[model samples]
Target: MNDRKPNLRSVRELTPALEFCTIHGYRRAYRVAGSGPALLLIHGIGDNSTTWSTVQSQLAQRFTVVAPDLLGHGQSDKPRADYSVAAYANGMRDLLGVLDIEKVTVVGHSLGGGVAMQFAYQFPQLVDRLILIGAGGVTKDVNIALRVASLPMGGEALSLLRLPLVLPSVQAIGAVAGKLLGTTALGRDLPNALRILRDLPEPTATSAFTRTLRAVVDWRGQVVTMLDRCYLTESVPVQLIWGERDAVIPVSHARMAHAAMPGSQLEIFERSGHFPFHDDPDRFVEVVQRFIDSTEPAEYDQTALRQLLRTGVRERAISGTVDTKVAVLDAMGTDERSAT
Candidate 1:
C-alpha cells in the first residue's frame, strides 16, 4: 500500500488571497493560484469565488486557477448596470484582458455556466475547453423558486430576508433538518441555499441578485438556451457534470445537453444535489483533472466558425442526426445572441 501524508492546511490556507483589479471602472475580486494552463472558475448566481474553495486549490496544483466574483457579488462593485449573460460574458473577457491572460479552460456552475457558454460563443479565440456543472441555459425548466424570484415585486419580497433573527432562525432550522434528512436533495442543498440567503440581507446584493435573476429567468422559466448553438462546440472540448438529485436544474438536462453536443463527456454524482463539487469534491477534482489530461485544448478557427455559422446546424437534420426535441425547443424561443 502507498503511504503519503495528507496536507493538513485549511482550504482557506491553501487558497490564494483575493486580488483586485479595475475593469470597465468596476472593482473585480478574484483568486489566482499556481502557474500552468489557465482554468477560469465562474460561480453560480448569489455566489462568490469562495464557492469554489473546496476544489480551487486542488485544481491549482496542476493548473493556474482563476476564480472571480462576478460583478455585484462578493466584494465586487455592485452597480446598477447590465447583468445579462451576454453582458457578463463581456465582463469576463475584459477582466481576462486586464490580467493579460489570453485563453482559458472555462468552468462554470449554475448561472455562471450560462455566462461561460456565452463567453465561448462570443470569444471563441479565448476559450480552450468548456466545463459546465449543474449549468443553466440547458432547458426552459428550472426550479420554481427561481421562477418566483424573477417575478415582478420579487425584489420587494426579498426584504423579508432582512428581518431581525431571520438568518439565525433559518440557520437553526437548517441545522436540524440537515441532520434528519442528510441524504435527501433538500438537505444536501440547504447549506448553499442558506449561504445565498445570508447575502440577500444587503440591499445592493439583493438588488443585484434580483436583476441578475430576471435577466435569464422569468415567471415562466429560463429565457435563454444554448442548445441551438451547441453544435458549434463540436470544435471545443466540453465536459458536463451534474448531481443525480439536482433540484435546481434537473439531471435530465445534463443528458439532454450531452446529446445536443457531440463528443462531450458527462458525469453524474449519484448521491449529490445542486452542488456536486461541495458534495464530492475529491471525485470532482479527479474527473476534472482526468478530462484535462486526456483532451487537447481546442484551437479556435475563425474561418471554420464562419463556415459553420453560414451553413447553420440544418446539416444535422439532413444527416438524420438532429435531436428533434431540441429542434422543437429551439424553435420555441428567439435566440438572443451575445453582442460584444
Candidate 2:
C-alpha cells in the first residue's frame, strides 16, 4: 500500500475545475470529469469536494465522477436554510437533476456517508451503488470531540478559532502531535483535521459546521442512524469502508452495519484513520473500481420496494441482531433501557 500522503496542490491541479449551478436559488459548486457511468462524491462536514481530489481523477478515468461541496461547506453558499441529512440529500438530487445526470454510484465519507444513506433512502431511483467511508449515522458511538462540539455552545466556541494566533497555535500543536503519534489514527488524520479546522475560522462555515454536526450528533454521540433502514438497501449494492484505527467513528459500526445490511461488502484499512482514501488512495480507487466492475448497478423497482416496505423486514433478515433492535427503538423515541 502506498503510505504517501496526498499533496493537496497537486491533487487540485489534476482535478477538474470547479463548476457552478443554482439549486433552490443558491449557488452550488461541483467538479465533474470523464463520461461513462456517473459517480457522485459527497464530502463530510467541515469538508469540501476537494477531499476527493486525490482519487477523483483516477475514478473519473473510468466513470463520470461528480464531487460537490455541500451547501454549507467549501465554495457552496452556506445558507442557514437547512443542514439536516435529508436536506443535504435533497440538495444532491437537485444538483444532479440540474446536471442532467439521471443516476450515479454515490460515494460519501464521514458525515457525507450519512447524507449518502439518506440519499439512497429518499431517492432510491438516483443511486446505482452506495459507498460509505468512515460514515456517520451508523451508531451513537462517535468521537467525543464531535459529541462536545454538538453542544449548544459549540457554535460560540468555534468563534475562538478565528481569534488571532489561535489557528496557528492549533496548527503547531497538530504538527507536533502528528510527529509524536505518527503511527496512530489521530496522527495520520491530523492534516485533514487541521484543514477542516482552518475552514471553521470563517463565521458562515462555522455556523454551517455547527448546524450540520448538531443535526446528526449531540452531546451524547451521533443522533441519527441508518441501521433501521439498512435492510431497505437489499436491492442496492452497498460497500462500507473504514479504518481499523479510526478515531472519529469506530470501525465496529462497520461490522454492525454489514450485519444489518444483507449482502453488503466491508473493507477495513489496517493502517488508515478517518480518511482511508487519503491514507491509501491507490487501494481505495482499486477497491471502488473492482466493486463496480464486479457488481451490477441497482435497478430501482418501485414494486419491490413498496412490497418490502409494506411487508417490513423479515425476522430472518435481521434476526440475532442487537443493533437493529436498538435502532428501531431509537427511531420510535425510546432508549435501550425501555426497549429491553
Candidate 3:
C-alpha cells in the first residue's frame, strides 16, 4: 500500500486570511487574497478551495481572489442537505452578498464549472465574466467513472475508499483489480477515483462528493446542460479553458461550447488532462490574466435580462441563440429575492 502523503506544494497558498461566514445557517470557509476586481474561484467536487491554490495567489495579485470551500467540501460545514447545482449557485450568491460584493469573474472547474454556470444563469447580475475550466454543464457526456459514482450504493463505496486508514490499501487493491479488469471503464476511472480519494481522505467530504455527483450525474451521464439556455449570456463574455486529454468531461465539450458561443474564446492546454490548471499552471495563469485584461465585466439589468430572454426567439428569426453577466441591482424589480 502506498501511504505517501499527497504533495500539496501547489495548494500552500492559504497564507491569506482563511475566513468563515454563515450562509443559510451553514458555516463555510474561504480565503480572500490580493486585491482588484473580485474573482471568485470555485473548486470542483470531491475537492475544496485549495484546488485553486496554484493559481489563486497569482490571480490575487491582479484581482481580489475569494476561494470558498463549498458547503460540503473543505473546512466548510457538511450537512446532509441539497447538493444540486441550483442550490450551490444560490449558496454562492448568498456568500457574495454576505461580503457585499456585487460582481465578480466567476471561474469554476469541473463540478465547479457546473456551479459557475448555474450561478451565472441564476444570477447573471453577479457575474462579470464566465470562465469554465473543463466545465461539466455544457454537455451530457461525462466519464463513466463519475456516472457510476452517482449510482445507488455508490456513496457507501465512495466513503469507504476515502477512509484515511483504508485508502492506501484500497488504492493498492484497486490498482491490482484495475490491471485485472483490462481497459474497462472501471480500469480508466478507478485509478482517478483512487488518486482523488487518496488526496481527499475525509468521509464527510467524500459523502458530499457522492451527493453532489448524484445531483448532476446519473447512470446515463450528466443530467444538466447549459446549451439550451446559453442564450441567457447576452452581453457577458465567456471564456473556456480545457485540457486536450480531459477524461472526466471530454474536451469535445469545450469545442462544442465554443462553437455554440460564436465569439467566446477557447484555449486548449496541449498536454493537460482533467486538471489543466494544475497540469500547466503558468499557461493557465497567463490565459486567464489575459482574458481578464482584454475583456469587460458584465453588469446585470432587469430590462436587459428581459431583453436577453427574448434573444433566442429573436435570433431564431434572424440567426440563432446565445448568454449573461450576473449582477443584482435595485433596477431589476421583483427579482431581488431570486437574485439574492
For each candidate, what is the lDDT?
0.86, 0.86, 0.76
**Candidate 2 residue pairs in clash (backbone atoms < 3 Å):** none
**Candidate 3: minimum summed lDDT over ten consecutive residues — where?**
324-333
Rank ordering of all candidates by TM-score, starting from the highest: 2, 1, 3
Model 1 earns a TM-score of: 0.90
Give the local distance difference test score of model 1. 0.86
Mark the regions of model 1 whose C-alpha exceeds 4 Å error after superposition: 1-14, 315-340
- Tell me the number of clashing residue pairs for each predicted model: 0, 0, 15
Off by over 4 Å in 2: 1-14, 319-340
Tens digits of lDDT, candidate 1, 63-178: 78899999989989999999999989999999899888999999999999999999999999999999999999977889998999899988888877788987788888988887
TM-score of 2: 0.91
- Runs of candidate 3 with Cα error greater than 4 angstroms are 1-14, 162-165, 172-195, 199-201, 311-340
